[model samples]
Structures are given as structure tokens and as C-alpha cells.
Target: GAGVSQSPSNKVTEKGKDVELRCDPISGHTALYWYRQSLGQGLEFLIYFQGNSAPDKSGLPSDRFSAERTGGSVSTLTIQRTQQEDSAVYLCASSRFLSQETQYFGPGTRLLVL
Candidate 1:
């Protein structure tokens, strides 16, 4: 089966413009995660969805950031107003089980706001 993948491997946009990044996880995966990583920085968890559990959005930086998973497979992260500070690699991961499961990561969607 296919592993996780993200679209627009790289993105460049002006401040205030909106952008949407997509992620496709492996089939049969029940847990999905979204994270952001600044250049040379570690990953920062954004949101996570597992089966019927309530999606965790605690790590979302601001109101401008949001995400949703459809049919527990593909997910999308949307930024309402692009900012220079938002420039980073957005990574997506998926796992079979929620606990102690190592999530597989995508190449990530790199965003650059100028």
C-alpha cells in the first residue's frame, strides 16, 4: 500500500493569502497527525484524529490554522492568512493504533510567505 504523502511539496504565497495543504495516509490507518516544523527545528504537533475520538486541536498555533479528516483517511490543513512566520514544513503522519505507535511521516508541504 501507499505511505503518507503531502501535496504542493513546496508553496510560496504572499501574506494574507490563504492556502490549503493536503495529506494522504496509508489505507487502514486509524490515527492521523498534523505537525509543523520550522527550518532546522523539531516537529510541533498541531492536531490528531483517531477513529471516533474527538480530534485534538490543542497544538494549533492560532485561529488561522485548522484541519479536518475525511472518512479517516485524507486530511487537509488550511491557513486563512499566510504570514512570514507561517513559513515552515507541514508534516503529516499516520498510525494504526493511538498508543505508543510510531507514526509514519510524509515528505511535508513546505510553505514560504513573502
Candidate 2:
């Protein structure tokens, strides 16, 4: 019954560096999603993966952002050439599917780019 989890909980990085954020989603979840939330802002969908559906990467901010999911359970988001504007909480969530069901979220990996 392990829930979603993210490492460090917080990260500080210099501008133009690279950072990798990890996410462990709940077991048996076939749908995984990556989202970003700025201070006081609503959640923005970044990418999503379902059982056999092609990964959706429409929300990726730019070329510097990429993500991959292995075994359909664990996912990692890598941000290259980090920018001050990238400072935000990178959140990961998973649900039975992207529908009426609620998507459980991890505590989040907070990135502070300076």
C-alpha cells in the first residue's frame, strides 16, 4: 500500500545546472502523471502515461525538460540548463486513470534555482 513519494523534498540549484527529480507512484496504478506548481498557482499537467497510450508530453515547459517512466511505476523528471524561472514544486501524481478518480500526489520536490 505504498503511496507516492519523492526524494529530498527540497532542492537548491544554481541557474543553468541540471537536476533530476524522482517519483515513486503507488503500486497497481496504471496511470502516472507529472505536474508542476508554482507558488500559489494551480497544478499544471506536464506529462502522462497510461497502460498502452502514447506518453503525453504537451505540457513540458521547454526542451530542457524530459522524463521517463520505467515499469510503469517509477518516473524521473530531469531538467537541464535550469533557470531561475524553473523554481517551483515539481509534483507527481497517480490514479486509476485520468478521469473522475482522484490522483494521489506526493509531498513534492521543491526546486529553488538561483
Cα-lDDT of candidate 2: 0.87
Q: Give the C-alpha miss distance for residue 69 in model 2, angstroms.
A: 0.1
* Candidate 1 residue lDDT tens string, 3-104: 999998999999999999998987888988889999999999898888634356778999999888888788889999888999999999999988899899
> What would the TM-scores of all predictions be?
0.94, 0.91
- Residue 59 of model 2: what lDDT? 89
After superposing candidate 1 on the true structure, give the runs of residues whose Cα lies further than 4 Å from its correct spot: 52-54
Cα deviation of 90, candidate 1, in Å: 0.4
Query: Scored by Cα lDDT, where does model 1 land?
Result: 0.89
Q: How close is candidate 2 to the true structure, as a TM-score?
A: 0.91
Q: Could you say which candidate leads in TM-score?
A: 1
Best by lDDT: 1
| lDDT of candidate 2 over 1-114, digit per residue (tens) | 479999769999999999999988888888888899999999988998785353567789998999888887778899999999999999988898767878999999999999
Task: List where candidate 2 sits over 4 angstroms from the true fold.
Answer: 51-54
